[model samples]
Target: MTVSKEQIAAFYSTDTLAGDRMAGIDGLRHTGIATFMRCPHRTALKDVDIGILGVPYDGGLTTRTGARHGPREVRNQSSLIRRINVATGARPFEAARIADLGDVAFTEVFSPATALPEIEAHVRAITQGGVLPLLVGGDHSISYPSLRAVTENGAKPCALIHVDSHTDTWPVFQGSKFHHGSPFRLAVEDGLIDPKRTVQIGIRGGQNITDGLDYSRDSGMRVMMIEEFDDVGWKQAAAVAREVVGNEPVYLSFDIDALDPVFAPGTGTPEPGGITMREAQRFLRELQGLEFVGGDIVEVSPPFDSAGVTALNAATLLFEMLCLMTD
Candidate 1:
């Protein structure tokens, strides 16, 4: 009773076991470390054994609307969309060797003052290892620490490409300079980032008062208001980003609020009439050739999310950013 070649092949394939099915801390990767620490239960579902970390602390949020749950939700939804890049045929994790390094160790429960330094330390360690860090958010404030880590040890200054609803250049808010609205300001002041080569895109909303406009101009950061993007188109915006960042290492920070509230209603601050997902993808895709060192997708609050739309969007953007880095 010998089996035919086709039958044998099928039997062997079916009998042979695939890779390990068990999930554990060993198999997971660490990018959203801070978020995982905030909610271990949610982290376990999204990360833990699944190779993702959720940093769910939104201490820097100005709206104080509780976006700390973003990391876990985004990870849980982002996992479903995983696939090999059709053009490159490379899985993002394999291409970049990204791991869920776990979250930053925060000493204080709700203090950006303490959390920022911790985040910096974690990012510095990851960067030092030559592995790119894809941070999930507590808020945009996390970017300052992540940038500091990248620039520390006298690493050459990197350009910043910020996609957000606001310029995030306010000097201070609510007697705290470390709020989410001021990371770019702090990063520039600390000389960790190259302001001359920095660009902020998708900036809209009422926060752009006289002082905000003046500060953006005075600091040498390029601002592409959302309205300006509609007029010039995404190709032109990408061109400006490339021209500003040039060949230097660039960090991309994406705030989900950059999208219209209809698409990303879960964000701490919802801004209407924002860029569409298609427009956002077009803008990000144009940076295919730029040197991206590190990046993040932040500000998705699950409590406010109705059908996990914002988390899915954030996850997709994170994956796209990872794809961009590979190029």
Candidate 2:
């Protein structure tokens, strides 16, 4: 739908730094269609700089099965988000033209084979129109299709900065090579991301076998386990990530499972001893000036948490990632 100038004007805030944000002191956050932070929802990218799109498919899940509901809940919780960052004073709404681009409409949401390429096509349309796509995902597997779309099917490979509890580099699972656990592996093999420039942080989980961990290390990715992250702290970890992906076009994929279950217990696969909410916030905050092509926050399943803490955290982190995308 066309977002008219009048509609855009109606969403403007009195705060000069807030720009064209919809939800602010004057606007009611709880009312209106639950678009990301209640931004004007539009399918067209005519006047948009950043497009917030949702992929609501969890067919790739090997564990729990509720991430398909993630986008909707995230939309509801994101209304709580305001215009400017109180800590960093980064006014994202002012920095760029942003809009809710609606969700990826799926013809078949039951299989990754057909579904993933659909996602790629949708995101490719956004990127082809010169709009940076910030996706909220159904599962971590969604990142593969997004990466493929953002990099134009590996014709231009970009660096990957992944935050997750698992390495996600395993070859395949149960005869399916396209599950959530193997997106990075497929991305590397397909040349969607530069393995040498890839860095996976907050990796700490038990394994029946260590093939994923071994592949992550063998592929030359800088893997920072939770142990090392604790010792050096978020600043050092963020420094290493920035150094690893230095000045290259980068795609950031933040899995909600990277946080300890205490903070984010609504993921399909929860790992103990993960980063705290504060550390995750600070870590993302430190990645302010990177060349971010696109980014995603994945695997927030609301069925597990009646209190909606996971969705809230995802919305906050989504704001942080949006700030990183700004000039």
Candidate 3:
């Protein structure tokens, strides 16, 4: 295909032509009201292939409170994103029936304990309605309920691709098992996630207890701690991830804490040495062909974020995941 100056000119001129399939009537990427990737903001999930849902409940945050604001900031920052994947040639919005389904509704928003079932119900509706959700964070705790919805309603337990600095497999936290530190553990116990088939990447930092670490090892999940990740590198680590998840329907859960403080400083629990944003993007891109039933980017505490660094990185990662979802 030869490049045409006329078509290129028209793309940036004013609006779009009738046959402009690339962006359709969405207008300029930076001009429109921002939804996730500027897809139409719709409340109904009917006939939608992918729903960009937001779980803006961070009641489980024992360290910091601002992750409750992640979804809004991510949505705002996503307006700067343009269609088409630079490396993989993926035009996600063009390829899928995607829309911003807005945030998940909860009856009592302040309590993480009360929020689990509501989040699960929201995800259950999305999954049952045949909509794959690309959720933005309230916090990592949302993963448990979301996974529960997927695994319980789908054909079987989901294989997880959890990218975080913490294993989050603790048996309990501060008298609550539903808190951020224990979602994966709860999921594993409830059979919502297949521990043997799961692969947790970018795990680093120290913890106060060995219970979670011990449980992760005993449960037989592939855990690539930061040092091991350094030895093998992200490419090989991604290959190992693919091998673990195999052909199962996978759920990708990313905590901003998985990123080094330099790349994403706004997370509730910041780890010293972790993957850079670029490496994270590259690794996520590597999962392009897998069966992604659902995914999320969590723990972006915009209140603590520096000059859009963390939120922008989160938005970009969401874009990468969106490309894979389209694939």
RMSD of model 1 against the true structure: 7.0
- Residue-by-residue lDDT tens digits, candidate 1, 183-244: 88888888878888989888889874556657777889899999998899888999999998
Shift in Å, residue 22, candidate 3: 12
Query: Which lDDT tens digits does candidate 3 get at residues 1-327?
Result: 586999788768866322223234545556645577666777777868998898898988879789989988998887777777788899888898888888887888767667888998998898889999878988889998898888874347889999999999987668878778888898888888889999899887787888888898899999999888888887998999999999999999999899999999988999898898888988988898999989889999999999878988999999899899999
User: Among these predicted structures, which one has the highest TM-score?
Assistant: 2
RMSD of every candidate to native, in Å, equals 7.0, 5.0, 5.0
Higher-scoring candidate on TM-score, 2 or 3: 2
Residue lDDT tens for model 2, 264-285: 9999999999999999989999
- The residue pairs in collision within model 2 are none
Give the number of colliding residue pairs in candidate 2: 0
What TM-score fits each model?
A: 0.82, 0.93, 0.91
What is the C-alpha local distance difference test score of each model? 0.74, 0.89, 0.85
Which portions of model 3 show Cα errors greater than 4 Å? 1-29, 153-155
Residue 323 alpha-carbon offset, candidate 2, angstroms: 0.8
Q: Is candidate 1 or candidate 3 better by TM-score?
A: 3
lDDT of 3 at 35: 70
